[model samples]
Target: MVLLLGIAAGLAYGLTAFAGAFLAVPLLVLFADVDYHRALPIALFALGICAAIAAGDAVRARQCDVQLSAWLMAGSLPTMLILGALAQRLSEPVLGTIFLIASLVFGPLLLLTLRAYANRMAPPPAALLDAPRRSFTDATTVVHRSTADKVGVLFAGVGCGALAALAAAPGALLGWRILERRLAGQPHLSVGTLALASAVLATLAAGWQFLFVADVPGYTAGLYVLGTTAGMGIARRAHKWLPQAPTHRALGCLVVIAALALWVVVVRGATAST
Candidate 1:
């Protein structure tokens, strides 16, 4: 059961670049009867490895933005360390409730955002086809960033790191949204930048878990690693051939599904306990 759950979680992590911890921790608690604390650390460790591999792929593809990644990680690393320590002291029920609330709130908002983006990308009526359009060069030109933009990026990074430490990946979801807004028309670069930052954050959080929070088993970690590697390979290949529209829509749906699953786990556990 543990191995099966690990693989399932790893596949989620690799394909979406999020949700491994979200899926793994709850499944571990419910099915394998592992405590939330122990489950989280193991999941974090596995996710760290998965993110590292994905980041490498992104860098090799020349889709990563090193300056953006560095600025994001500057705020994330210390925040992760602090929040990870705090997570160790929280009760399982408290953590579960937090996860439940986050899922409910963020899930619908994300779905709505995706729908809106899709609408924006849809073609206009034939009457408008003759209307003047911005030149390709003008449309793709990189925008200058203000101080507010830099601050927003840093804030998003801190938020992402904190959530990750607490066994959630919604922070990464939020980071992606922020990046997408800032780096419009460059989806690959925005995603790759986030991937690199996520790799660093996950690794630091996992190391903290190993040293202070829990002792993860080698076999369980191995299973997750294997599954994530396979999933990453599949996703990488698919990205080459698939259109961006459908891919974004699919990702939005997957986030909703994962969020609902998390809510069910926490709510059911709470009800059972009471």
Candidate 2:
């Protein structure tokens, strides 16, 4: 049962960058009979491993931007550690409520953004559209970091870290939106950079959980790692063969489903407590 849960969680993580941690946490609680607090750390640890694998693949494919990832991490790592420590002190209900609220607020926005981008209807300026694509392998293709871009990265990092620490995979969706806005016309690079940044942030968050919160289950973690590795491999191969429009639509639907599940959990917890 534990192995099966891990595999299911991993498959969810492997399939979508935005919804993995979000999907994992609640699913862990519901399916694995884990408490919300325990589920959080487990999901974080599993997500870190999965993100690392995905990032490695992105790097190997020359799709990731190292400099961009570094800047995002600089802002995200410290914030994640601090918030993760704080999260340890919060009660399960409070954490669940927070996740529920975040899901409701951001879920629809994410869905809309995905649809807009998929349809090429996002209102990015023509100048951004004309900006040159940065090559992961070729430093010459890298553009100078503008002040605005740096600020955007910093803000996005803080938001990502805060969300990662609180509950669910807020970082992935937040990072995706930020990267998409800043790196217009370069969807592949945005996705690659988001993966790498998420990996780093999730790893740090997991480390904090291990050190301060509780000991993670080895069997579950190991199985989740295995599942994530396999899922990412499959996703990478299948992505090319799939159409973007349908994929984006599917992801949007997933965000909605996850959000609804979180809401139900929060409501049930409230009713039971009352």
Candidate 3:
């Protein structure tokens, strides 16, 4: 059961870091009956590992824009460390309320993810969503020409980190949205750099929670790390043959939904049963 849960969690995360962590925390806390307080840390850590691994390809592509990225990180790191700890101290109700607020603010992005997935299955006008973004990768380069743009990124990154430290549910769409306008002009940069940086920052931020903030069972973190890395490797290999391939895209979306449903049912049922 432990191994099975790890794979399921990792697989979901492998598909996309946010999707994985968004759903995984409830599974670990509510279903696995790990304390919710500790679960947040583990979830954050898990996301960090997965995002970093997947972003490796982007790092190799020279799209990271190190200077601007540094600014973003500088703004985010302290908040992640601080708010993440504060989050650990809150009661479940308080945490839920906070998450509710974030969900309201950033909930539309998940709709976008849902829409993209539904479209991949079959075009749906009712989807009310857009494409699954590469987060910060496709955006941000054009902003580099001006200091004001970099400062904007810094503030945005800080905000994302603060929210992410709280729950990470909003960071996906929020992070991507932060970059969308900036990315509109710089088509020359590969998605790799942005991908890798987001992956790394998230991983580090998440890892801090797992290692320092939570009480994850023995080897659970290792399992998350290994599973996500392997999943990323698989994705990279597959991408070589079918860049932006329809099948892979669809598969990613369906996998997320299926896994998320599993998590909800298992966790929610367990909660009600208890």
Q: How many residue pairs clash in each candidate?
A: 0, 0, 10
Over 85-187, each residue of candidate 1 has an lDDT whose tens digit, in order, gives: 8887887678876766665556555556656776433211111112233355544465567878788888888888877888646266777777777777766
Give the per-residue lDDT of model 2 (tens digit) for 161-213: 88888884747677777787777776666777777888778877877776765
Highest-scoring model, TM-score: 2
Q: lDDT score, residue 10, model 2?
A: 65
What C-alpha lDDT values do all the predictions have? Answer: 0.63, 0.67, 0.52
1 or 2: which has the higher TM-score? 2
Off by over 4 Å in 2: 119-142, 266-274
Q: Candidate 1's C-alpha lDDT?
A: 0.63
C-alpha RMSD of each candidate structure in angstroms: 7.2, 5.0, 7.3
TM-score order of candidates, top first = 2, 1, 3
Per-residue alpha-carbon lDDT of candidate 3 for residues 148-215, written as tens digits (9 for 90 to 100): 77777778777868777776532544454455446554321212233444555666666666655534
Instruction: Estimate candidate 2's alpha-carbon lDDT, on a 0 to 1 scale.
Output: 0.67
